[model samples]
Every structure is written in C-alpha cells, then in structure tokens.
Target chain A: MATITYREAVVRALAEEMDRDSDVIFFGEDVGKAGGVFKVTPGLYERFGPARVRDTPISENAIVGAGVGAAVTGLRPVIELMFADFAAVTLDQIVNQAAKMRYMSGGQIKVPLTIRAAQGGGAGFASQHSQCCETWFMHAPGLKVVVPSNPADVLGLLKSAIRDDNPVVFLEHKVQYTEKGEVPDHTEHVVPLGVANIVRRGDAVTIVATQRMIGVAQQAADELSGEGITCEIIDPRTLVPLDMATIIRSVQKTGHLVTVEEAVHAGGWGSEVATRVTDEAIWSLEGPVVRVTLGAGIIPFSEPLEHHLIPHKARVIAAVKRTLAV
Target chain B: MSEPLSAAMRQQMLQRMIEIREIEGRIQELFLENVIRGTTHLCDGQEAVSVGMAAVVDAAHGDTVTCTYRGHGHALALGLTMRSMVAEMMGKVSGCCKGKGGSMHLTDMPNGLIGTFAVVGAGLPVTNGAALTAQTKGTGALALGIFGDGTPNIGAWHEAVNLAAVWKLPSIFLCENNLYGEYSPYADTAPVENVADRACAYGIPGVIVDGQDAEAVYAAVKTAADRARAGDGPTLIEAKTYRYRGHSRTDPAAYRPEGELDAWLQRDPINILAARMIADGQITQAAVDGLKAQAATDAQAAIDWALAQPHPPLDAVHEDIWV
Candidate 1:
C-alpha cells in the first residue's frame, strides 16, 4: 500500500484505466496541457497525448454531451466538468440523454461514460461554483452516483466506473483532493458500484455519510468516543444503487441514525437517506433521523459565511449527540 | 440560381415528402378517431426539410442524425421501420422504444439514429455530442441536427454550435426554418437575416436554401456533409420551408394569415419534384403513381401492424430506466 492524496489517486486511476483499455480517455476544460485547474489530471497529457487526454472548449454541455456520444459509440469516456455546479448547464444531457439513453433505447444502447466533477465549498467558492449538488444526480435514476471519501475508495470506484457499461456521476469533493490515505498498491483494485463500506463499527448511532462528510464523521466519532458515544460510520461509496440494505441493517442494530451531507439540508442527499430509513427501518429507530447538513441557501463568497454555510465537525457531533440522546 | 436536382433523385425525394404528408394526415385522422393515443407535432408542410436533408445523410455506422419534436418524417426518411415507429406512436410493445417513448420521443439506435427530444432545442446538444464523439473516435461519421428555426435562439443551440465549431466536429446543423415557432410567427420570435447567418458567428460556413425545393436543400446538405466528413468542420444550413398543418393536434392555426397555407401548398416539395421529374422526361407518370401507391401501402401496413400489436405492460415502464 502507498500513501496518496485523493487527487493523486484519481489521476493514477484514470491513467491506469487508459492504459488498460484503449477506449478509456479523459477530456474536459484544461484537462490536457494544463492538467486540470486542480491538477487532478497532472502529467496525463504528456503520457497519453492529446487524443486520449484532450482539452475541450469551456462548454459543459459539450463536455458531457460529447462524453455521452463517445460512450454510446463504444468509447469509455471520463469527462471532468471542472466544478459540480456547472453540471446544471448540461443537466438535460446528463439527466435526459445519458441517464435515459439505456431505458429510452430499450437497452439497445449503453452509455459507458463517467463524469468527474469537483464538488463541495470548504475552499470558499461562491454559490455558483461551491455548491454540493450530490442530490441532483442521486435523484436521477439510471445514474450511478459515487462519492468516495478516501484515496483508496476513489481509485477503486473510478476504475470500476470506467469499466462499467453504464453512466456514472463521480462527485469528487474538492476539499478531499489534498486529504491523504493509504491506497492499495495493486493497479487492479476495483470497487464495485452500489456497495457501501462500514468505516467504523459501533453499537451507538449509525453515521451515514459520503465523500468529504465521511472524513468529518470519522473525526467526530473519535471525539465522541471519549464521551462513551460509539458512532458507527458507513461510507455509501455509490449513492444511486445505494447500499440501503447495509445502512438499514446497521440502523436496525444501532436503533439510531444520523445522516451527514455537505449539500443544503432541504432536499439534499441526506433527505433521501432519512426518508429511506424512515420507510424501511422506522420501527427499529430509537428516535427521529437526525440530519447534519449544510444550511439551506447559497454558499457565500465570504470565507466566514462559507464556513458557516457548510456543516462542520461540531455540527456533526451535535447531531450525533441529538440522535443518541434518547 | 443553381440547377434544382437530377430528374430521378427529384422524383424519389418528392415521393418521400408525399409519404410524410400522407402518414401525418393518416396519423391526425387516427388520433382524432382514438386509434392513436397521446399528443403529436405534425410535419405536414415541413416534409421538404426532412426529406431534403436526409437525401444528403450517410446513415452508415457511426453517422448519426437527431431530430426535434416534428420528427416523424425525419425518422421515416432515415429508414426507421415504419411499423415500429407507428407502434411507438400507438404505445405498443413492439414500438421502437418498446412503447415507453411516444410520438415526441422516438429512438432507433440500430440505424445510427441516436434519438430525438420533445423539447424544441434539446437535439442540438445531442447531435453536437455525437459529432464530438465521431471526431474523437476518428470514425469519419457526421451528425445531422434537424431543428426548427426557433431553436437557434435557445442556449443549447448556441452552446452546441459554438462547441462544434471550436472542436471542428463533423456536424451539420439543419435548421428547418418553417417560418413559425408553435403559435408565434418567425418575425416575432427571431430577428436575423437568416438563421444560417448565425453560423458565421461560430466560424463556420452558413447557407440558406429554398426549403420548398428539396433538391436545393439536398445539394447544400450534401456539400456540408462532405466538408464535415473531410474534417473541414460544422456547417449550418437553413431550409426555408412552411408548415401546412397546425403545430400540434390541439392547434387550429388562427395565427396564420389568409391564403398563407394555400400559397405554401402551391410550392409543395413533393408536387414540385414530381413536376420536375415529368418536365425533365426522366420518368413517365406511371412511375410516379407507382411510387405513391407503394408508399401508401407501406404506410397502411404500418398502421395495421401497430393496431395488431399489444400495449406495453405497465411493468415495462421501469425497465428502460437503466441498461
């Protein structure tokens, strides 16, 4: 195993996938010579050349729409949308075209495409660029939503997404780019979609989170350990074919649930988890599903307001306390 | 200014236009008679654009075409099985989309017909995407995007064209400028010399054709398709046509002027092509009549097959949501 940052893992995974399959390629704005704004695709252009690693026009619709077309024609294209918020510019292609192609075509066509976008707002990106739009993709059926909290999960899930014969929306929280973790050295570490991992096992409240929120939950869990609140954290690596079974069973055992999401509290990813838990495991719940989410509204440009808008570790801890209080 | 078309291709083109007109006429009758359920956007007068542009498309592997709501003629002309298309309109199990998609949503993937969108300008991005894919994969395929005049103003249209030009994608933007967008007239909707003129803004050649002249459109599209396949980049061709029918089944067309429909009918693409074929002495009247008869029989057979097909099972609604 080697210690690597989430960003490094993503680059490695994309490079390895391109090497493994000639059909696999990466394209997006500044993804070629510049190696992406965050350098997530660093050194790839030189290694793969322009055909496999391309820099596209500053059009989100073209970036994703091109990816969809390429995928349907037998190329596995992984496109970067720079930021998650820009996905709205091409939601029709993503939701209407890519998400519906398989079903609309009666399974005659497959969109073997993956969209990687930098999400979350801890870096003080304003509302237009900083919003965590995970729920938008999760709400969309036929799309596999994957949000890995660590380098290992990111590498594994991306590799799997590239090979899958379906469209996947891989939301990489920008804040997690620098976060380091131990990733397996194996070049073929594949993590299947629709599977969740139990990061920490505890009998107390079950902390269901994804991507950056998983790290925050882990940090909160460590602090809560001294207070005798053993929090069980579950990282739902993939959100669409959600690993609800694992989460439901965990909630049943713990009898308490606290869902964490970086997006706005209103109609966020946490809401889906909360609703599912209520419908499936309501009788097993010791109390209402406590939701630790960002305040409903835009992410402010000001650093302090941005920090205030997103849910912090303290908020996560408080929610865990509230859920376990009964 | 240029010669219209060769006698043989002209007659064939006119037959296609008539086929679309007759099929749409039959569809309207069936819709009112309750034989066909759901809404429809007819292409009665706009037959020339579909037939004219389709005359130039390659339609081979990798080559794709995406149409807008008024897409029946486009689908049929691209060789989509009339039976499956009619079945889809009837919401039957054997429909092109397995009955999930109705008239507005038609998909024929096996024919390299990517799909069409109900939303007016939605197909622009889709076709542009296909062109982008073709360019990246080095397939030498061309994507023909058929949209109405109103779509050029939409954001998707601009984004699609701009991206295509920047990437030098092998795409042809076929704007079927039928002079109206639903209830509103073109003057009220768009303010430009021509929709194709906007293509110059994207650094691509733009041309306008007499939409009522199928040969004129075919010529322009053929040249554009050649340039695209040769890696010269995208082209925008505005086919100036008119719609004889209302925008939808519910529209009575009160927005049209006196004799406007009659004036357009006089310049019908099919009749004009038929006349040219006779004047050029390439084929006898008997041949034109025979093609029309064949098209009618084919259309009737489609209707019969659609009527005999079973309705899609309610369970199948959730099936296409994923591959």
Candidate 2:
C-alpha cells in the first residue's frame, strides 16, 4: 500500500487503465497540456499522447455527446465535465443519449463510458460551480452513480467504473482532492460497485453517508464513541445500485438511522435512503430516521457562509444526537 | 466537377427512393387506419437526400450514419429490412430495436445507421465521436450526420463542426434543408439562405446540391466521402429539399403558405428521378410504372409480415436495460 492524495489516486487509476487498455481515452476542457483545471489529470496528456488524452472545446453537451458516440462505437471514453454542476448543460446527452442508448438499441450496444466531475462545496466555488447532483443521475435509469470519499476508494471505484459495461457518473468531491489515504499499490485493485464500506462498526446508531460526508460521519463517530454512543459509519460508495442491504442490516442492529450528504436535503439521495430504511426496517427502528444535509439554499462564495450551509462533523453529530434522543 | 453516376446506380437510387416513398405512404395509411398508435415523423418528399448519401457510404465497410427523427428515408436507404422497421413502428418483438425504439428512435448498427435522434442537433456531436473512434482506432471509416436546416444554428451543431474540423476527423455533415424547422420557416431561424455557407466559419468545404435530384446528392456525398476517407477532414453538404408531409402525425401543415406546397410537389425527388431515368434512355415510362408497382407490392408484403409479428412480452420490458 502507498499513501497518496485523492487527486494523485485519480490520475494513477486513469494512467494505469490507459496503459492496460488501448481503447481507453480521456478528454475534457484543459485536460491535455493544462492537465485539467484541478490538476487531477496531470501528466496524462504526455503519457497517453494526444490520441488518447485530448483537450476538447468548452462545450459540455458536445463533450458528453461525443463520449456517448465514442463509447457505442467501441471506445471507453473517460470525459471530465470540470464540475458536476455543469451536468445541467449536458442533461440531454447524459440522461437521454448515454443512459438510454443501450436499452433503446435493444442491448445491441454497450456504453462503457465514465463521466468524471468534481462536486460538493467548501472550496468557496459558489452555487454554479459546487453542487452534488448525483441524485439527478441516480433518479435516471440505466445509469450508475459512484461517489468515492477517500483516495483508495476513489482509485478502486474509478477503475471499476471504467471497466463497467454501463455508463457511470463518477463524482469526486473537490474538497477531498487534497485528502490523503493509503491506496493499494497494485494497478489491478478495484472496489466493486454496489458495496458499502463499513468504515467504523458500532451498534448504538447507524450513520450512512457518501462522498465527503463519509469523513464527516467518521469524525462524528469518533466523537460519539467517547460519549458512550457508538455510531456505525457506513459509506455507500455507489448511489444508484445502493448497498441498501448493508445499510438496512446496520440500521436493524442499531435501531436508529441518520443519513448525511453534502447536497440539499430536499429530494436529495439522503431522503431516498431514509425512506427505504423506514419502509423496510420500521419495526426494528427505535427512532425516526434523521437526514443531515445542507439546508435548501444556494451555496454562497463566502467561506463562513459556505461552511455553515454544507453538512459538517457538527451537523452529523447533531443528527446523531437528535436520533439518539428519540 | 463531380463524376456522373452510372445508369445502373441511377436506377438503384430510383428504386431505393421509391421504396422509401412507398413505405412511408403505407405508414401514413396505417396511421390513418388507427392500426399503429403513437407519433411518427415521416420523410415523404426528402427521399433523394437520404438515398443519395446512403448510396455513397458503405455501411458494411464500417461507415456510420446518424440522422434526425424524420429518418424513415435514411433507415430504408441504409438497407434496414422493411419488415423490421414496420414491426418497430407496430411495436412488435421482432422489430429492429425489439419494439423499444419506435419510428423516431430507429437504429440498426450492423448496417451502420447508428441512431435517429428525436432531439434536434443532438446527433452531430455523436457522429463526431464515431469519426473520432474511427480515426483513433485506425479504422478506415467515416461518419455522416444528417439533420434539418435549423440544427446548424444550435450549439451542438456548431461545437461538433468545429471539433471535427479542428481534429481533421473523417465525417460528413449532411443538412437536409426541407425549408421548415417543424412549423417555423427556415428563413426565420437562419441568417443565411444556404445552410452550407455556414461551413466557411469552420474552415471546411461546403457545397449545395439540388436535393430533388438523387444523382446530385449522390455525387456531392461521394466527393465528400472520398475526401474523408483520404484524411482530408469533414465536409458540409446542404441538400436543398422539401418534406411533403407535416412534421409529425398531428401536424396539419396549415403553417405553409398557399402554392408553397404545390411548388415543392412539382420538384418531388421520386418524380425527378423517374423523369431522369426515362430521359437518359435507361427505362421507359412503362418500366417506371412497373417498378413503382413492384415497390408497392414489396411494401405491402413487409406490412403483412410486421402485422403477423407478436407484441413484446411483459418480461421483455425488464430486459435490455443493461448489457
């Protein structure tokens, strides 16, 4: 195992995949010589050359539409949208063309396409640049949604997403790019989709989270353990094929559930998790499910306001306390 | 100047156009009879553009064609079985897309008709991607994007054209200027009269052709296809034509002015081809009539076959969502 930053892990996975498969290609705005705006795709253009690593014009719709076209014609294209908030610009390509092509073609084609985008707030990128829109894709059928919290999970999940037969919306939190973790040294390591990682095991209350919220939930778990309130922290890496079984099992054992995410609480992924847990394990639950999320409001550019709006360790702890009190 | 097509190729083009016209006519009849439900965007008069372009590109040789929703002509010209297409419209299990993709979403990848997108200008970038795949994989193939006149003004079209031109990708952007973007007149939406003129902005060759004449479309597309295969980058070919029917099944075409439809009808692609075939001493009026009769018979046989096919099973709905 080798310790690496989340950004480095992303580049490592892409480079390793490109080395392993000639069919894999990468493209996006400033992805070539500039090595991406966030430097997550650094040195890929030099290693893979212009043929595989390309810099596309600033057209999100075309970028994603071209990726779908390339994928159906036998190329695994990893397209970057710079930010997840820009998914709105390419909604037709992602929701209509990429997601529905396979099913529409009667399964004659397989779109092994991966769309990588940085999401979530806390970097003061404001509303238009920072939004966790994974739920929008999760609601759409024929799409796989992956949200990796740490460096290791990012590497593993990205590899799996690249190799998967379906189109995957791989979201990486911008704030987590500098966060470091021990990633598997080997190139072949992959974390399969639809499996939740039990980051911390506890029986007092179950805290289910995704993306950066996993780190927040873990911090809350650490604090809750000292207060004699054990919290089981479950990180559901992929949202579409959610590891609901693991979440339900944890909820059954703990009899209390608190879901956390960086996206707004209204119609967010946390609501789905809460609804599912309540529907299936209502009898086992000793309290109502609490969802710790950003309130229904736009993310401001001010650092203090942004921090206040986004879900943090304090919010997770409060949600846990609220659920525990019930 | 483009080389003249042979007598045999002209006859083949005539037959293909006739087949499309007859098939669409039959579909109109079916729609009127209330046999086939749901919406269908038919290309009754703009047959020459699709047939002419399809004649130049060898789909069996890996060339791909992406077209708009009004793509029955494109599908039929690309050699998709009439039975499968009609069955798809009928929503049968034996349809081309297993009844999943109806008339608007018809697709046949083996014959290289990638997809018929309902969204305007949506397939331009997709076609560019196909061209990119061919270029990257060293496949000697070209992609053709067929859309209406209004699409060129959209962001996807401009982006796709610029990308294809910059990358020097092997592609042909064929715009079938049928004089209307659904209900609106083309002149109102576009700044230039000829859609081909817009290609100058992208630094690619642009040419205008008489879409009513099949030979003209074939020659223009052939030149463009040859240029693409020789790694000369993409070309924009604007086929000036007119659609006989309304945009969709529900349209009454009251938006068209008096004498406009009649003026376009005089330049009908099938009639022009039939007249050309007779004047070239390739066939007599009697033979042309015989061919039309044969096409109608063939279309009827396909309709009968599609009618015999069963509806898709309930379990099949759950299938094809993945893999």
For residues B233-290, what per-residue lDDT tens digits would candidate 1 score against the true structure? 9999999899888889999998899999999889888777778777888777888788
Candidate 2, residues A199-231: lDDT per residue as tens digits? 999999999888788888888888878899888
Among all windows of ten consecutive residues in candidate 1 chain A, which has the lowest summed lDDT?
Answer: A291-300
User: Residues B215-315, candidate 2, lDDT per residue (tens digit)?
Assistant: 89999998899899889999999999998889899998999999999999999988887887788788898988888999999999999999999999999
Residue A113's lDDT within candidate 2 is 96
C-alpha lDDT of residue A151 in model 1: 93
**Native contacts retained per candidate?**
0.55, 0.69
Q: Identify the runs in model 2 with alpha carbons over 4 angstroms from their true place.
A: none
On residues A182-276, what C-alpha lDDT tens digit does candidate 1 reach at each position? 98888989999889999999998999988878878988999999888899999988888889999999999999999888878888877888899
| Cα DockQ of the candidate 2 complex | 0.81
First chain of candidate 1, TM-score: 0.97
The top-ranked prediction according to TM-score is: 2
